[model samples]
Target: MNWYVVYTKPKWEKKVAEKLTQIGIECYCPLITQVKQWSDRKKKVEMPLFNSYVFIQIEDADRNSVFEVAGIVRYLFWLGKPAVVRDEEINVIKNSLKASNIADISVSQIQVGDKIKLETGAFSNQNAIVQEVSKTHYILVLESLGCVLKIKYK
Candidate 1:
């Protein structure tokens, strides 16, 4: 069985993973403990490391079985196919989390001329090429949309 990514409804990553596991589907949802604060007090809460995403191990034929659980929106697709996660990559995440001294982890570095996909906003899911990178903004060329976009840092 290969590992695949599942996109879930907002704030439902843990729930979907739990339900899938109850149904005998092997799943993983990496979580981190974060300190949350309110006017009165502060509390530690576990939050999904990757929002709206859960990883599952399943065969190609059994892909649809995950739909039996609610909150699972669909499989994340890349290059016109369901995105597959190698077992080693999963292990890296697991091991890094286990290491107490590690304070932060960055997924990747975006450089000029790199091809990237926008994850949110008006260009959501659209692919673009990095034209220029600045301290406050990025100039990207969206070939699919036939336009250049300048995203400024907030």
Candidate 2:
């Protein structure tokens, strides 16, 4: 058996994985917990790390069975065949996530000049241009208001 990546409907990775598992297919959907803040509270939500993709270990004979599951779109193909993932790589990802706390995970790839929104705080929903990037904060320019503010990494 080999691990194959399957594309799923938007926000359906976990549901598809569960359906595959119910049919005795071994599937893995890596999730990351992200804390989102609202005016009243902050909540931690688990989101799929790979977005709309799930991994399933199966032989070629079981391909149709995977497609039968709702929300599963198709298998990711490489070189005209289903792409195969090494077990070692999967184990590495699992172990790394398990060893980290929710606060330790950070995704910071926004570049200078990227248009972004202030999702929280006083400027919630306002758009800003990233004026500068530092190790732990962003200096953004609110062009409409002609003001610059530094936002700390969340």
Candidate 3:
């Protein structure tokens, strides 16, 4: 059996994993603990490592088992088709994440004050201060120009 990434409906990874397991399909949904502070009290909560997704090990021979699960949006798809996630990659992802003491914060994936150096262009060698970080680029304070410039980190 090979592992496959399953995209689930929003906030449904655990729901889907439970449903899948009920039908006898093995699945993995890594979770982390986080403290949720409310106006009145704080509570610790466990949340999925990857929101809206889980990894399941199944074979093309057992495709129907996956479909039997409710709330699985679909086996992750490519251009109009299901895609396969390799066993090794899945093992690496699962092991590496499980080994870390992860906190389940809904913080932006990108953070301010990230230490980065320009890799290319005229500012190649300069150490930059990340003024703002975005999904597509980092707004950096170009010390030489005394202005902010966005660099595509991807």
Best by TM-score: 1
Indicate the residue-level lDDT of 93 in model 2: 50
Q: Which candidate number has the best lDDT? A: 1
What range of 10 consecutive residues in model 1 has the weakest lDDT sum? 99-108
| Decoy 1 TM-score against native | 0.68
The candidate 2 region of ten consecutive residues with least summed lDDT is 99-108
In the range 119-140, model 3's lDDT, one tens digit per residue, is 4343444555678765555566
Runs in model 3 deviating more than 4 A are 79-81, 100-154
Clashing pairs in 1: none
lDDT of 3 at 28: 88
Better of 1 and 3 by TM-score: 1
Q: RMSD (Cα, Å) of candidate 1?
A: 8.8
Residue 138 CA displacement from its true place in model 1, Å: 17
Please write out the lDDT profile of model 2 over residues 17-134, one tens digit for every residue: 8999999999999887889999999999999877788989999886888878999998887678887877755674576457533223222687888888755444445567888887
Q: Rate residue 149 of model 3 by lDDT.
A: 50
lDDT of 1 by residue, 12-34 (tens): 99999999999999999999898
